[model samples]
Target: MKKIFSFNNIKTLLAVLLLCMGSAACKKLIEIPNPVDRLTPKDVFKDSAGAVLAIEGVYLNFGYYELSQGAIFNGVMTMQTGLLSDELLTSSADNTFVDFANNTLRSDNNAVASVWSSAYTNLYVVNACIEGINNSTGISEKNKQQFIGELKVVRAFYYFNLINVFGPVPLIKGTDFRVNATIPRTPVNEVYQQIVADLTEARQLLQPAYPTTGRERPNLHTATALLAKVYLYQQNWSGAETMAKEVLGAGIYNLETDLNNVFVAGSKEAIWQLSTIKSQLYQTVEANDVIPMFPFMIPKYYLSTHLLDAFESKDQRKTKWTAVSTMDIDGVLTDFYYPFKYKNNTAAATPREDYMVFRLGEQYLILAEALARQGKLGEAQPYLTEVRVRSGLDEITPATQPAFLNAIMKERRTELFCEWSNRWFDLKRNGTVNEVIGAIKPEWQSTDALYPIPLGERRLNTFLEQNPGYTE
Candidate 1:
């Protein structure tokens, strides 16, 4: 396969649209020879129009890479299953890997390997686009700066996903992908710093109003929302609370009239979405769709006995995230579980709606948690209740921070599963991967918190380093 970073040659971009599940068709873009157009940043970003087009490209590009971008989450609920069940975490390791049954992992495992290549490849593409825009002469000056900043912000979102998944990463901030065959890991803190800087700049450059307003494209709101989240990841509660509330007050989004509709698209609740059209959607609903919790892939994700038990009887989430009963062969009724949110697989070509990446309503919950953590319980209650009521659960009156935060976390799980990288991030940011989920999943390792840098990436770029504990 031709690697994406061969900047010296013009190649056709294989645009595989992730519109509907399993029903993708590829289109080739930029099918000409590569040329190094010499132009100052001033020449390109001089008009907002070019910058706008580039931003449009960013949202459009997501369909090409979103699903395969990160696969482990779709495949494994948590690393612990590797120890408890042999069925979980199956893939080509090219190494004698008995660790899953043993519940312990070395740095070189296959599950962690795919992510390093996938995410970095994505970052590199974004970087290439950023560089292309920076040097192009067709855009306006002010828009040029904003476009670069905005792209970095989105890139940071992807990088943060990498950092949380693969621990420390060799941070690549430029378009240059030329380096030796293997690289060493950079520190986690450094990765965090870069994400923060990108988001901060993004927030500054994005207009207060999103051009896709309340849609699933990165806009001023999503950018700020991410900054607050990154701050929370870093334990900057005050900053988290500040940014979270700013988004809340903006009033561009809502909690949705019905909680179920939040995932069903066209709901005013969406902030940003990963989208697909009808013809592009897959005809079959697989066991891996992010909706309704229990995945069809058995060990990859079974509703944790804990997760299954988390909801109260009236909680609307239970019916979708977990499948207590299902139909089997001969049309026999058997009790089992599968992802319910995206369970509808009979679309003609693909799912009609794109996966929502961010929603305005989600920030309300974030604000509730942030404010509650910062000692603003009274202000947090209504926001929390909006989601609770929408989800068919009664609101809680948390008198303490732990209670409030716990509610926020659960709400997020029930509301946002499979669309965003919420589950993984929440596990890391809350330090719950090892705690709330650890005992049942004994195979999880502190090191497994981060994905191992992919072997292919290691073999391709010397400048990029392998994440810790992995070997070439």
Candidate 2:
């Protein structure tokens, strides 16, 4: 693991203290100052309010430029992985994107580096928060549990992304820079076991109700939803089914009938969302990143033909979630389609959208897949039908187990695209990366399932090792 404080110049210990303190008062967390005033972790977590602010500060880290909003981890990885799969196509000549689209990624790819660095950097904040909350003198036991619960989920979430992207990764649980700097990669299964342990504890510690009105903070259901996903990735069918059913049975969320309403701020479907900071120009990073100015105005990415063809003619998602543009190609008129999931491109007086992290619709799919994988097709049909019915499509009834599994996979691909590298990870976890993605991307190798560890990180940490098929 890389030393947390030294990883980014903007994230000094003093700056981190101020950033945590500033989260409660500032309207925008990222715009906080970098003052030189020094304070230990104890100083910041001395009060209940400061502890709350420190936890909120971790949410700000999630929305940072390199992580989710700025198209490095969530935004860029979503598009690039879609391109790597069959859901997206490169719309520009940018080599950074084309490499992902083409499955020719190298160890030096900046996006891969950003994903690695940002994840670990944010994980450091979460670990520190966990330590502070546990050792606080003035904070109540109830408050400590709530804050620590949220921090554990955040920590597990980063590890979830790390292990999925890079295979085995160092599982750093403490905030000790000296210990973490020299840690070696843990086995992928061991890392997942830690994730499961963290989330299970988090589920117990969290309240049923969301901490804040915005659903920006993780609650019991949020932890449950993430745990369901972790179980699904591990192919723990019964566990995944039970967890998904738990979230569904809670009755706190509903599937959005209107697909267009799902991504907007305060949607009932959103289980956990990232609250956006108001800006003079862009409403949210996703809106500015995805919505194109015109049909052929060189958007960062566009929907792939394969993805466009996956939808049925009457599927409302195709019309509601995507847009078409016209361009003149030589003598004939050509049209291109782009993801229109986020429609607000410019900033408004208030935020038009918040980034959706977890939602109710995905739970249904998880339940469907879990049941289908366990050979319980009869029990799975209704859950799969629920998602399809909401999307204005006919209910599917796959007779055979293999057919039902395929249906669930297809539903996941269409429903969850462009959200948190879902398609990429799905193809990987299903062991079809070489079969499905390789057919589309000729250069794709079995070893390409996991991305190369960032070269700089490998050099800095002697214990770190590169993934297969990459050179240091």
Candidate 3:
């Protein structure tokens, strides 16, 4: 078992806040680390620079863990969920990925625990930052509000993934560990209510333009785009259409004509991206893990045949977004396919991709699906066709609402494949988990739609209940 750390201590909060700073004080802070030693939150938030570092620390913690190490930003959701959803296949039998591919996850599974623990760890940091920002007198009211808004939106992002994967999770909106440790899981709808509230207020607090260089930080449009996705998941079609249209019409982003350039840093297609100074040499985790380094080198994870078969004929995505390589397995030459969306694996002076979080391409699909769900087939046709035309596929003009909805789902599966577990979440949202996964795996069960709540968490908080179909 991995060593479990408690966030109940004020010292724990200070250590995480300081150690994650990634600045000159990081080494100094770590040297004095002691669980029994306590530091007041005011000591850290006493100045504006400290306040800024507190927030940056949250992002640094995200960057500290890469895809191979289970970073929440792109790793666990994009890869583990991909394996569970049939979008990816594990190449070796010795790895933990086989459990995900086989859909036999347990509460004790380390990867499952990693996703749960990592999210809560970040959440604690974000919540502490929000509280510190509010209490700090050194920061201007304007900056404090903006900082709180940013933290809230980040908190929403964490909860969004937790609620989606775990079904229901304890909503820890504050940094009080005593209260947090015993809180029962909040209902999915209530958790979403908090997410909507966070994003809605964040949109009002954030400026139209990004706060920092590039599109790394969440901006006004970023909140709107995420809210649109939230509404779509809730089946609020009109709300989804309104929010999605706001992003699509903002004139800030454009659909990249060239598929190869979409994932590049600062691309107009990106709504929100995350960058790591530490990864300046590695470029991106997607490239490092998916691309083979040498001839006959097999990738650890590759695209599944199920995902490859979903693409239409002559589709530009199938050709441009995927790549093929050869390897020798048991002395027999074998061909393998993998995602090549971000194609830089070797060390370089400058990085190419920033790990896309939200992009304009998804907004187009959201708008198309929302409009179609509302029976506005003709109005939705152009939005749907916009994505298709860029992919070198013929413009789709589905005559019926059902046909348009079906078309949108297919496009979503192909366009958003291996992205943020879109395919896994889509199957659950569309109520097709049983129908789709059952046909593929004979051992599939309806309850397998939701992963088991980590057993460590259950041991920590007795109020927590496990998702069905897992042994206690």
Candidate 4:
């Protein structure tokens, strides 16, 4: 088995806080080694062809986004971020699983640090590509501008994931991070502005197309899906619904008849995703702490008691997605049962599956939630039912806005599992984070929502400050 370092230690937190993009990136993001300087932005952008190489590196050096426990690790980009996540603790190798009810800290080892750093590195790379596109005049104007749009959406995705995890962060649009360390944290609102800005520009840049095999690269549909999510996260139901409906109406995507196809690589539903192209997927997944043991690895969370009880007994998802176990009086299995369909012991068993960064199924759900919140539950039913019927569940019939919203959240949690930290963030965004996990985890106070920015960055850049309730 490939061994992943524990993020539980204050030391491993170092990796969790920063990322090593390339030789240049390693120096800017990490401290241990003197990173070898491979290429400079000026040297890279000296020609239009040179700029293409640098842009390719953005995809080439992509890290495994889904850093879950080793098992379901490869593509879980949204695995765990921030302090509210329930991942493995420090000394995780010694302790197999954390006792959620008894643990003192609500967080596992991962934090928003590395995610924030790596995304900026990506932004810098993309922005430099735009710089080259603007400067190197030989390339066709249409091609250069199109490349810029593509690069911006990719950068916007990076920033969106970072802002989601780290709250307000430094927004750099160039390759001067060494000196730019002095730049202070941008307001969270401003960060969102940048994300929205990048994506909006991408919508106009990307061609209206659907790519079946190469979902890693952003397409028009992917941009649309991302805009839908950005609006939903910002609580702009109308904006969210409008973009979501566009994707639904666009003939580019649909829920796969086979639900299992959703998680497998090369599925039709994936919009834009992170692929293990230039990097080894094994390196990223093995380092995960929480992904291997719970849900998929050992199945610790067998549908929260409330969730298992909430579903109607006949609900197809409950039967297909979850399982209940009963032991004989002699402590032997009376009948074996399991609760989920996306089982890939091989995901932990081996690093093969590419994580889905964005997919069409999620877009549908985003549409459902956005529409339902807009007091259009009846209109949202078809999107909700498409996923439900595919999962073998009966069509949903949410009557009121509140009921529809609650069902949408449940649908999100159930449909999107082991992919990202969406489960944790969903509760936070819905204002039910404390209410639901508070009793299950007494350590999860309201202050625990955002992560404590690494103390190192605070010293490196005095302009930086910790998130609320975290000590410097």
Candidate 5:
């Protein structure tokens, strides 16, 4: 049989397999014939170009409507979680935003299902890439390691998000559909261990410089930055501090002096970003989703009053990162604010902004928090100061450890809001979710910290357990 090895063909194969795996009848559907004339992994990897294209296919999955820029991972989850916490509030009749903003999310929510399915679907592609790259005899050893390293980083990224959102998600590291179809949730701690291991190996395997010219591809520093965050979440302060400092010391990135330019394409602050090149439908999905085209138009969501009040009067981020408008509510003209970090929403052929996954601003906060946790308050001051000074705020001088940590948490809340689940995760990790969010949202419960596992997923796989406080 003649073997076909092409980029489009490989992408189609991966997409079909992922679609099958994401279906309710995944087991039966996934048994369908492999595309490319049932080409073995060897045949696909035999051509170095095909192997590279296979990995690029994984990146394409990152930009999928359900995954990165769309409503699931980077866009929706970030916005809704902001609403769930305190960064945003519902302004429209969309039930999904209304449900999340009101702290009344259901397991059957389509947004919830999309996040769960898309994350795993992309993860399946990552595992497939790792397996094919490792088993390929045609590829050089160096090329194999590079591909495997990048895939490991992507896998760790998905697991990190999964564990954070669902508490203990099933850790699927292999491409065995039979086993993955029924895998149960792994312990949260165990999941962190796997993340650390993957990131550590990835950091070692990747080069200091990014593999690609842009920040879209993972590098040693990219792995280090993520690993630092993993360590921070795990309370491994020394590990977190060490890894964070390594990235900073590399001199590859710097805090973008102009706060407004941080999210622009080719930013100096970007450690890892997702290119919108593959997303032809929208130039910047997160921007187009959150920001309204006209000043008076009500956006799908708006910045919460709580977040608006959190910023100091002179803080540049409030002015530079958010947009203010006045809209008629009933007969009264009311003022509203929405996140404007991504300023461009036009559907131009070349994107003006990139969805930032990791950046120097986050690293600065990560290092500061890690240092503060280790009781190095004085040492942590400079890193925190760097971010604050850039935000046009004066340096803070907290007298005590608790005060310093609180400052770091507050800084994270303001600096990272609406970018990802930064505010939500910071609140959860700092053990102030109930005290902070509950005070603002009366419906806030401790159990609300973990989103409900999608109802459809529970029905499809009997082994999957529902999160507490959600219907099984």
Candidate 6:
């Protein structure tokens, strides 16, 4: 098998790609030999294998890499956003973690800038792939459509996170840095519209079956699954219900009976998972960072009191997904609980877990919430109960629509905690950020509902405006 292509200098390559934009006029964009070290857009999309390899690079970015500031998809969202919300508490006094936890984020926060840059960096690659695949004549027609569809799903996912985290952001559709740098922040609603459009198109072009051997790539249902989430976030209750119900009933996945199995690589519940590139050190960055070598050792990141107290009694997630560390504190044993969702810290010959991006569990919650919001309490109860029962909790009895919605949200807090900033995004989307975060954090402010646009980015692009409540 041919090795996956590597971007020797992504910046320089992107600059070259900018001049080689795919168009009728630019048809014979300078051709170079197919060397794996260097890949031009023309060389990349010249054939089906090259097209597939180009997108694989995008997936590689999401897995464990040696970058000092980790890529956004590679557990960055879970850690930073986890701190920004109440899901996690860190022992380290890093200012980046401190700002997020205290809700006093400055424009120059290194963490914030890393996230911004990482996301756009990946987005550029995705955009380039889309352009290359579309412009390619060597690749088969079907492959081109599916590849573009997959890229759109990824692009939508990035923009969705950007919209949620930064309120408004530049929606870069192409690989031209000059144009992207000068683009102003698009409104949140407009960004959502674009996300909806991308997912909508993606759903049409993708096939139902996994494009690859594993669930590493997005399928037709994957696009639908994400569209469901997009609808849920937009409060399109009916649309959310339709999309979630389709995935839930498509017979593709199930809720893992053992909560511990839910996050394992290629688990039955995973709709989309990010495959890890095995290395000598660890299978996943999240596991290596969050899990201590010894059971009795305190972890770098542990559950916050707010999150620890949220789980109800007999909740298996509290037992199965979390672990306790008993440390000797001056002859006194102190216990600290931390997330144990990803169990493989050491690199095994075969990985036990892949970074879970989407799964059947979230779909059930989405379906239940969508139904409950539409006053279909009777219909929604079963979906919510399925998840609860799987976790060894008693099934909830029927309740009013509002009560059902509340229960669904509460269940989301416990079931999805520390996974992907679910708690933080939920707090913001549900308008409970100030109430929940403010009760715990005295530094919380209404303006903190959206993070500041990174200061360095704003300085570079004067067109980019600062989010309210941040200094220019």
Best by TM-score: 3
Full-model lDDT for every candidate: 0.56, 0.78, 0.81, 0.58, 0.79, 0.80
Give me the overall lDDT of model 5: 0.79
Q: After superposition, how far is residue 29 of candidate 1 from its true place, in Å?
A: 5.3
Weakest 10 consecutive residues of candidate 1 by summed lDDT: 11-20
Put down candidate 3 lDDT per residue, 348-434, tens digits, no spaces.
624367679899999999999999998999889999899999999998688898888999999999999888889999999999988
Q: Give the Å error, residue 470, model 3.
A: 0.2
Instruction: Tell me the spans in candidate 6 whose CA falls farther than 4 Å from its real position.
Output: 1-40, 64-70, 349-351
lDDT, residue 311, candidate 2: 85
Model 6, span 19-49: residue lDDT tens: 3344222323334444534555676678987
- Candidate 6: how large is its RMSD? 5.5
With candidate 3 superimposed using the best TM-score fit, by how many Å does residue 416's alpha carbon deviate from the native?
0.7
Which residue pairs does candidate 5 place in steric collision? none
Candidate 3 wrongly placed segments (more than 4 Å): 1-5, 8-13, 18-38, 64-68, 328-333, 349-351
The TM-score obtained by model 6 is 0.91
RMSD of each: 5.9, 3.1, 2.7, 7.6, 5.6, 5.5
TM-scores vs. true structure, each candidate = 0.76, 0.93, 0.93, 0.76, 0.91, 0.91
User: Mind giving the per-residue lDDT tens digits that candidate 2 earns over 1-472?
Assistant: 3536452322334435544553544333333343434346666677787777666667656653222522233465677677778888866787878888888889888878877877777777777777777877989988888898888888888888889888988888776677788889999999999999999999989999887778888899999999999999998999999999999999879998889889888898999887665345665666677777765665667787888888888788888888887777788777678888878777673437777889998999999999989999999999899899988999878899999998888888778877888988988888888888877777878888888888888887889988888877
**Candidate 2 weakest ten by summed lDDT:** 64-73
Candidate 6, run of 10 with poorest lDDT = 1-10
Clashes of each: 42, 1, 0, 19, 0, 0
| Tens-digit lDDT string for candidate 1 (350-373) | 334445556766677777777787
lDDT of 4 by residue, 1-472 (tens): 0011122112221322233345342332334232324333344445555545555556543545434232112433333331234321221232222322223322232333344444554455555567656776566666665678778877777677666656777777754445566777888889889889888988887877633346766778778888999999999999999998888788866677866566555667777655543333342342233324432234333334444555566556566554444445366544323334344433343323455667787888999888888788888888888877777778768778888887887788777643566776787788877787686675666766665565656666788777775556
